[model samples]
Target: MIHQGRLKEDSLMVMKIVGDAICANENQLRRYLSKRQSASKTSSTLKSLRKYGFVERHKSHLAFEEDDEISYKPPAPFTLGIGGYKLMNHLYPEHSFTQPEQWSKNSLAIQRYVAMNEMRCLSVEAGVLRGWSWNPYIGGSAKYRSPLAVAKLESPQGEIQLLMERPQMAQNFIGYYRTKLEVYRYLYERDKYFKIDGFSKANLQIVCLYVSSSSMAKFIQEEIRLHTFPFDIWLLSNEWISEEKGMSEAFCTVNQDGLKRIRIPFLAPKQM
Candidate 1:
């Protein structure tokens, strides 16, 4: 247990990262803290934070069937606890902080959340992630829809603004995807892009869709090709993101002729 006086700067930084992400696994945390501290130090700090109720562990199960019986797997993640929330609220009075609720046992939801956090960590390492907002409101009215996340990436050209979506590959997922696309198209036609507080009004540069498989990604590409939009639409899969280059991997987008592979301009090449 750490006393108030003993709570080090590293620990506070860990809490802030976790709070910003909503949840993060041990590996992601290590990557985020790599520049300032060693892996072993991060491990010990996490243990202390968990012990002192600054963070809570959540083990999401991966269900599978073997020999006609269902089984489960593990990769526990961490979220901010009550103490951490209170501390953040007190320290940053301008921003409202809420304690995260217990995550559902659904495997798909957990997987998507973990994958999003992985992208965020990778972006941080590449030094391109400027800002990230989870489920932020896009328009002033209630009729408008919100994307899964909004991010700003620093590029030589300028800041690359993205409205990101990651739909679950369920039976009716296509319908959901179409609806989300329509909403963005409507907003685009009306000249109303994302109006985030403390940021200048900017056009939506890209709509990034992160799917479950390469097949799904190809299908989404075809769907996007069928439509006309002012902004770019890109598709990436879990397989590609989990590869050696991670987010530095090329993403697929529709062009005038056909599908084309494009890389984010700002992402630095992965260090060997």
Candidate 2:
């Protein structure tokens, strides 16, 4: 007798992480998986999950081999397929799973998130960040505007709210860029308050950490510098995932003061 409960628990943690991040690649999965497990076992388990239609992969392929006959190369990212969504509905009925259709359209967005999760995993290993919080407003109405994602990283210094965004890169880049800057400027200069939940406000150091193509990053940096925006913002390139140096080298932030490189233990995380 195959117990569905047991099957669900077999890779429950993996599902939670995938569902939370919207998607993740195998490399990111290994960080949260049990270190004692062998690589072969991990690959086999993932294969079985795919066979059962619990998870589906994105079009992009990673540069690695998974000891599987199904494909010569493994997929880059994986998300909850129809079956996986059903499992989630069974586990948490309070949440709705009626709209799995939208997940496919957001593949590019998921790619950016997968990269951010990789950075999150690295931060955990470096002992700089204890944990992070994914914005809870997803798939729901937001009372106020919010970042594409908000990661609250807790460190000994203090907590820092990393506003994650992957804005569209189009020919009329300036138009899109100005809209985002204006929104942040309003949040910074006008509101002067931070609210995570309905009630209560805790003023914390908020920094915009955007991930985009190198060309876009350069243009955005120039825009911020040329205009001399008063709010604090950071520009991260897609190459951030392949960076061999520390986080310090991976990003640069701009403000009225000037442009500067940013690292973890990010400049006293007190209320700004």
**Model 1, TM vs. native:** 0.82
Q: After the best TM-score superposition of candidate 1, give how far the Cα of residue 210 lies from its true spot, in angstroms.
A: 1.0
- Candidate with top lDDT is 1
Give lDDT tens digits, candidate 1, residues 1-272: 35676677888888887777777788888888888889888888888998888888786653221123334444478878878888877777776554555454443565556668877776776778888878777655556778777778887787877777876423355677788888878776776565643456754478887765667666666665523766678776656664456666646777666566666645644573
Please, what are the lDDT tens digits per residue for candidate 2 over residues 1-272?
Answer: 12665674556656655666566777667655645355565556666777777777766532211131233345467777788788887887875442356656654455556767766665654545644555534212375455655665655556666666654322244665566567666655665644443223334555554554445566566665623655456776545534344354567666555456556433222221
User: TM-score: which candidate is best?
Assistant: 1
Please estimate how well model 1 matches the true structure, expressed as its whole-model Cα lDDT. 0.70
Candidate 2 accuracy as lDDT: 0.56
lDDT (0-100) at residue 124 of candidate 1? 79
* Number of clashing pairs per prediction, in order: 0, 0
Worst 10 residues of 2 by lDDT: 62-71
Candidate 2: where are CA atoms >4 Å away? 1-8, 34-39, 61-75, 94-99, 130-143, 168-174, 198-203, 212-216, 238-246, 255-258, 263-272
In order, what lDDT does every prediction score?
A: 0.70, 0.56
